[model samples]
Every structure is written in C-alpha cells, then in structure tokens.
Target: MGKSGQFIKRWKSLSYDGKVIFLKSAVCLLLIKTGLTLLPFLQFRRLFHRITETSTVKEVSPQQIELTVWAVDTAANLLPFELLCLPRALAAKYLLRKVPSLTLEIGIEVNPAKHFEAHAWVENNGTVIMGKWPESVSYHRLWAWK
Candidate 1:
C-alpha cells in the first residue's frame, strides 16, 4: 500500500481542458496493441490457460465485472476498443456508488521476467473505478480505502 499510495499521491488530476485535449489526442490513437485486436476472444484463451495452470473459473470479482460493464457502457460512444478503460476512471471519480478500494496484481506470461507482474486496482467506497498508473501490472502498492 505504501508504494502505490506514493505513486498516486504524486499524480495530479488532468484539468477540464487538459482532459478534453487528452480526449482529442486519444481519438487518433490506438488504445491497446494491435495484437490485442483479438482480445475479446483471447479472454477465453486466457481463461483456459489459467484453468490449465491454476484451475480457476475465471475469477473476475463483482467489482471487476461491474467496472468492466461500466467501461463498456462508457466506451460505446467512443472508438471500438480504444477507450474501454477511460469510462472506468470517470465512473470511479463520480459514479456515486459504494465500492471498495482494491488493488490487483496479475501477471501475464509473455515476458515474465520483465513483462509478467502485478497491477494495482483501486476502488472507491466499494466499487472498482480506477487502477494504478501506466497499467504496468508489476508495481507493488499501498493500502486503499473502501
């Protein structure tokens, strides 16, 4: 919790115009890697691989599911797969829902030494609305509130 807290503490919010400028810049950008164009199907592949490796039934928490849904809703008006996560950030800021501030750490196997690691997810009150910076999924974090 300590490290993640510090990372977030150093972050400043994007101003309204800054946010708008960011949005404009994002419009012409690619959200995920081109390889991830198949990500929707890859979720199943990831599920099977995880099951084969650890035998888990796709363990997305209620908070994760809710936020994913919210992300989908918020991204609908935007690019195809480009803005799926932005809505979750906005929702976390003003969704007015009760959710826990949870930190998540998941490791992907492509480049385990450097690429494979953990991520920090943060929820507000009880709902997961945002995540740690850079989405590196490797950094350790601090205690988040619910």
Candidate 2:
C-alpha cells in the first residue's frame, strides 16, 4: 500500500473521540505555525492566551493527557511540513486549556558541539505531557507560563 493508503487506514482505525482529538491537533498545529510566522511572539502568545482561556477549570485523567499527547505527536508527524517543539507545545496547551495545572515550559542548552538549542514542552501538575525526549533532561529550564 502507498503512504496515503496507510495514512487513511491508520486514521480510520481511530475511535470517534480519537478522530476528534486528531483533527483538533492538526488544526491547532496549522494555526500556531501560521501565527508564529505572521505575528510577533508576544502578540501571538497574547492572542493565543485570549483564545484558549477557559472560565472553568477542570481536572482530567492521566489517560486523557496521554490521548492528547498521542494526538499532537501523531498530527505533527502526519503534516507535510515540520511542526517544531514550540508549536507542538502551544497546540497541547490549547487542547488542555481547561486544565488549571497546565504549564508551558521553555528550556535551553549549549551542546558539546558549541551549538545553542532550545526546546518547548507542556506539563500538567509537574509531569511532562509533551515534547519530552531522551535529551530533554539536559536542557536548563529558561521560562514557563501557566
């Protein structure tokens, strides 16, 4: 089977809620990617904050968080263009906006090769919900937003 056919099969295998989550992740990724291109960082963040703000805070299960991570990761992979860590973090934040414990974190590191790198991730109640990798522990946390 072709890549398109495999993609369709994988997509069709998802349950209804999974499908919804995937769609949300894909849309959020597109919006954040575009927003980052067109707007200043601060302005785009403020707009994103306003858009994702929720009146009521709710607690969600670990499984829900896992599902969200899966959705975001899967959506990012399926996109024709790359969606970097910052956009992925922002997208997860949008999905988990109602969760009061959610936080967006940025970390930086200077590699042995003398290259500076940065990463973004989201955490809920002190546990990383997205953007974690084996090297993630090496990064020094620069900032976080709740």
Q: Pick the candidate with the highest lDDT.
A: 2
- Worst ten-residue run, lDDT, model 1? 91-100
Q: Where is model 2 more than 4 Å wrong at Cα?
A: 1-10, 110-113, 135-137
Query: Can you write out model 1's per-residue Cα lDDT over 35-142, one digit (the tens) per residue?
Result: 235467467336423432422234446644454433333333344453433333323322222222332222222344675443334453443444534434334434
Report the Cα lDDT for candidate 1.
Answer: 0.38
List per-prediction Cα lDDT, in the order shown. 0.38, 0.87
Count of clashes in candidate 2: 0
Candidate 1 ranges with C-alpha deviation above 4 Å: 1-77, 84-87, 97-112, 115-120, 124-139, 142-146
Using Cα atoms with residue i matched to residue i, what is each candidate's TM-score against the true structure?
A: 0.25, 0.87
Local accuracy of candidate 2 as per-residue lDDT tens digits, 1-146: 98668768868888898789889999999989999999999999899989988898888788888888888988898899989899999999999889999999999874676578899999888888798868534877899978
lDDT of 2: 0.87
| Model 2: per-residue Cα lDDT at residue 19 | 88
